[model samples]
Target: MPAKVGAVKVNNVGNSSVFNIGDVYSMSPESTAKTYAGGGSFITGDGIRIRLGQSTTYVTDKDKLDQNIT
Candidate 1:
């Protein structure tokens, strides 16, 4: 599974990320490709980086969808 950035803290994303404590970010699945939100920057623990609120970014699509269908 890919790294699913969810309702997690920015600091938790990367041990040394600029994402401050209490900074909530919108996360998207691997399918959509990009995942960022309203104007922010985040760095992964391993250095993978992404910026929030950038056009063409997929972070704006933050909504709980049901993947498990009966």
Candidate 2:
């Protein structure tokens, strides 16, 4: 029952208790809302894959991408 507004969720495809997973909505899985598919560019759901947007690399002591996320 931990629902968050404007929270992005991956579809619980196989979960018998899952709601929806292809877009964005203002309410929780039980509420009436639509998914946000970047016009066939992105998909969110369990087992479903998506190409994430380009990542930005900041200058660290090393040239590797920062692994520490807050």
The candidate that wins on lDDT is: 2
Candidate 1 lDDT for residue 11: 33
The C-alpha TM-scores of every prediction are 0.14, 0.15
Which lDDT values do the candidates have, in the order given?
Answer: 0.44, 0.47
Model 1 residue pairs with clashes: 36-59
**Number of colliding residue pairs in model 1:** 1
Taking all chains together, the TM-score of candidate 2 against the true structure is 0.15
lDDT of candidate 1 over 2-58, digit per residue (tens):
354557533345433344334346633333233444433443477565554445545
lDDT by residue for model 2 (1-70), tens: 4445576766446532455544555643332333333443454577875555664444345644334333
Candidate 1 weakest lDDT stretch, 10 residues: 27-36
For candidate 1, give the lDDT of residue 32.
24
Provide the lDDT at 4 for model 1: 48
| Model 2: worst 10 consecutive residues (lDDT sum) | 28-37
RMSD of each: 17.6, 17.1
